[model samples]
Target chain A: MNAFVQLDLTPLLIGVLAAIACALPGNFLLLRRQALIGDAISHVVLPGIVVAFLVTGTITTWPMMLGAGGAAIVAVVLIEAVRRLGRIEPGAAMGVVFTAMFAAGVLLLEQTDTSGVHIDVEHALYGSLESLIWLSADGWGSLLDPVALAGLPPELPRMAAAAALIALLTGVFWRPLKLSTFDEGFAATLGLPVAAISLGLVVAAAVAAVAAFDAVGSIIVIAMFICPPAAARLMTNRLERQVAWSVAFATLSAVLGYVLAGWGPLWLGGTHAVSAAGMIATVSGVILALACLLGPHRARVGAAREA
Target chain B: MDTGFWQAFLAALALQAGYNSALVAVGAGLLGAAAGAGGTFLFLRKRALVSDAVAHATLPGIGIAFILMVMLGGEGRSLPGLLLGSAVSATVGLFLVEWIARRTRLPEDAAIGAVLSVFFGFGIVLLTVIQTMSSGRQAGLESFLLGSTAGMLYADAVTIAVGGALCVGVVLLLRRPMTIVSFDPDWAAASGVSVRGVDLAIMGLVMAVTVIGLKIVGLILVVALLIIPPVTARFWTERTERVVWIAGALGGAAGYLGAALSASAPDLPTGPLIVLVSFGLFMLSLLLAPVRGVAAALWRHRRFQHDVHRRQGLLALARREAIFDRLTLKVLRREGLIRPDGVETPDGAAQAAKVLRDEKRWDVARRVYRDETIAGRYDGLTSIEAVLTRDEIAELDRRLGPPVSVGPRIAGAVP
Candidate 1:
């Protein structure tokens, strides 16, 4: 129990929060056929943080966020420019831009004299979810102690706030977002700012990605952004139910993945904890696979042609 | 940054650097050419991003291969063994992406993202598990992520070179059917081309390129080699065959240059440098390629705008109206169609009469031939002479007869 409080709780909370935060915007992305935007956003985060570190000479949260946000904007603009100017497909443009940016990020990380700072490609990919331990926790009572609470891993609160903010934004903009995702022309005819809404959705996804990536890794950010929402897509035809299903799947993946990574190896008589971030992503994929096989609405019965 | 770097770069470019650097450079060039050739079909097929999933999916296979090799009492670092394992797993990931996209309602993009992240995550999990093994500390498996050329074994280079050559050969042989299918799947199916079979063949070729490129470009940046060159080549041509060949040439150049640059300095990583070089080519193409480039498009638009303004100004001159639009007057004056004070020069008067005649001919043709095709061609700028025969224009002119004297002398009054 003490180990659970001191070690498991913070990582698990952060993982769950990150998962939910990403999955929320992911539902709309999946519906809108922009699902890989999450992938592109996450890939560019490395460069964003690396540049932020270079300029500020520190890894503070705000600087990293601002840098990452700036990178996401640049990536989006470049993708659009390439798509328009070169007459390339959205997928190809996205692939080109993100890969180049990611390559630049890796090069920068290698060239800079980053000796002591915890900034590198491996750290961005797998994350340090296992190390965000709560040292001040003694047991369950530590949850109620103000001093112990103050020592809780900063990721937990930050992820929680991010997840909460995403949920609130999703709730507030549910109708127009759904309308635009389904029939863009119809939504625009109804006086909706379809273009702005689409951009807004991409912006929201970028925020979720940048916030969640710091804790759970880009792998988890991508998996959560895709797998949970995609599984939910198979499970329902309605948008509201799909969002609810996605959130549940995200929560289940985080908890089950954290537990399996932390203790499942020992249960099988192994030596140490595996990567929590990886396990969470693996679990989410398993969930998606299962939903693909069994979800009632998995077939495109009422679906129209994709744009 | 140093003279030694320059000397080394030039030596590597000439294939006289050393046995190791030359081998690495040749392997990179061959792999880039193959990937560029094979990726043309994917870019045309609109499935270019599938390479990302296939590339990332190779990780778990690498881990499992390492463990299996260790168990078999081998050093567990054979490049062929690792490539074979990676190929197997990448095939599985490709199939999964296909299966999920087909069986479920999720789009292909979602399937790609899902498979990519999961396979990579599972692979990381396996890596962590491998760390528990006694021999895992010296695995040096991380090199695959960014690629390394410092000690590329001769056998490894030979394998990559041979594999890339084979893939490019296969791409050439299969180009006919693959191009047919990529252009129009429904038509290809109707014409007995076996669209599914051709798609599977394209995927196989792409998979071969990805596996072969794993050593030179690494997986994460491998898709860049597949995508950037093809996209860059697209700016220079409209034909698929030309695009494929140009892409191969560009990819080969980028790879060769990148390898030489990296060989020049230990600090230069091969994968990013290759991608950056490729991006540099893509940028040049985007900005300056003829006909399709940004600069060319802007130039075309400007010239088109000038023509429209001049054409309208001439028409207005025929109408004997005072030209007030600044752009119209400026365009007319520049073209020698009007004098200093908006007066029509003799050349301008003749051109305005011709313009008015074409307008009246079009107005008559619209009534004479009400076919949608001919009427639809009217963009207010196309001259009736271009659309109709001489006889047809003569008939329209006969219908209007002797041209009502609009007295264009008002604008060309020779004041």
Candidate 2:
């Protein structure tokens, strides 16, 4: 039990928090037909984090987050510019920008003297979820002790705060966001700033991705962004119910995946644990797949015809 | 760090940097060309990120292939075997992407993101599983993530080169049907071209290019070669066929140059170096291509602004309204249409009279002709002569009976 508290508690909570944070903004992105924005934002976070590491010479949290936020904004502007100037469509423009940025990030990682630090391209992909152990915890007793609580991994609190903030913001701006997403012309006619709302939504998604990235890695971040909300979307037509379902699904996958990753192998009589991050993503994908298969509204309203 | 870098770069550029490296460089060029040509269709179809999903999906296959080979009492490091495994998995991923998109209500982008991240996560799990195997310590599979050419062999290079050339050949043979489907799937379907079949074929060919590129550019950055050149080519021309070959040429050049440059420096990785070179080409095209480039667009905007200002100033002068706008006044003076004191020159008076007559002629013509051919042409920029024959303008002129002297009055001092 002590071992579980010391080693597993923070990572599991962080994973849950990260999953919920990403899924909140993801619901809006999926509806707005801007789902790839999450993918692009996650890819560019590599360069953003690497540039931060190089500049700061240490692996601090805030600088990395700031650099990543700045990079996301830059990528957004660049994609828009390329789309408008070159007359390329949005998909290809996004493809060109994010892939090039990711390549630059890889090149920078290889070129730098980062051997002494724990940060690398692989680390950036998978994150340090398993390593964020709270060694100061002494089983359930530590949960009530302030001194023991102070030794918790920073990501636990950070992810929780981000999840809460995104949830609050989503609640605050629910009406305008819902209005613009479902009926843009009507929203504009109603004197809503449609364009600003769209931009704010993307910024919110970027913030979610950057915050969740440290605990769950980028793979889970991208998956969480699309899978849970997408699954919830299949379950209900109402935006509020879909969001509620998505949060539940995200939380469920995180806890279930973390437990399976840590102990399922042992239960099967294997000695080692697999990656918690990978398992979490796989679990979310499983949930999404299940939702696709069984959800009430999985099929399109009419016979399948894409616009 | 020194002149040594230049010497090395020149040698690599000349393909004299030893046999293995020369082979790798040639292989990279061929691979890049194939990716560029093949990816044009996907880009045109607006499904470029599908390649990302396919590329990432190759990881688990690689891990599985290695474990299977080791269990079968082989060394488990064969490049062809691994490439085959990756190809198989990429095919499954491709089909899954298509299936999920069609079967579910998810937009293709959401499907793409879901498949990419999920498959990649599963692949990572398999990679961790492989690490527990005894022989996995020196598996060197990480190279498939960020490719390395440092110790690559001649045989591996030959396989990649041959595979790349074959892909390019397939692209040539499949180009027509692929083009038809990419431009308009419905039209292709109506014309009995088998839209789904052609699309699947093109995606298969892209998978082939991606598989071959795995050993050199890696899966993550391989999408760059597939996407960048076509976008860059788009800046240069509008024809789909032109885009295909032009992207091929650009991809080949970027590949060759990037491989050579990476060879010149110790710190450079081949995949990123190649991608950056391609990005460089893209940036250049974005800024410099004629008609479509940023510079051209800006110039077009400037010229349009100038024309609008010039025409509006000429109209104000024709009406004898004092031009208050600074840009309008400056344009009139700069065109030698007005004197320094804002009065119309003798030549300017004649030009302004012509302008006012055209405006008046358009006014009468719009009311006279109820047809779109006559009235729809009046955008303030289209000239009256361009819209009608001399006879039509003359008929309108006859309705007004006589021309009014609206030009500058050369101080008929009674005013």
Q: Pick the candidate with the highest lDDT.
A: 1
User: Candidate 2 clashing pairs?
Assistant: none
TM-score of each: 0.95, 0.96
Residues A218-305 of candidate 1: C-alpha lDDT, one tens digit per residue: 9999999999999998888888899999999999999999999989999999989899998999999999999988988887765535
Runs of candidate 1 exceeding 4 Å displacement: A302-307, B1-4, B408-415
TM-score of 1: 0.95
For TM-score, the strongest prediction is 2
lDDT of 2 at A85: 87
Top DockQ prediction, candidate number: 1
| Full-model lDDT, candidate 1 | 0.90
Clash number for candidate 2: 0
Q: Report the TM-score for the A-chain of model 2.
A: 0.96
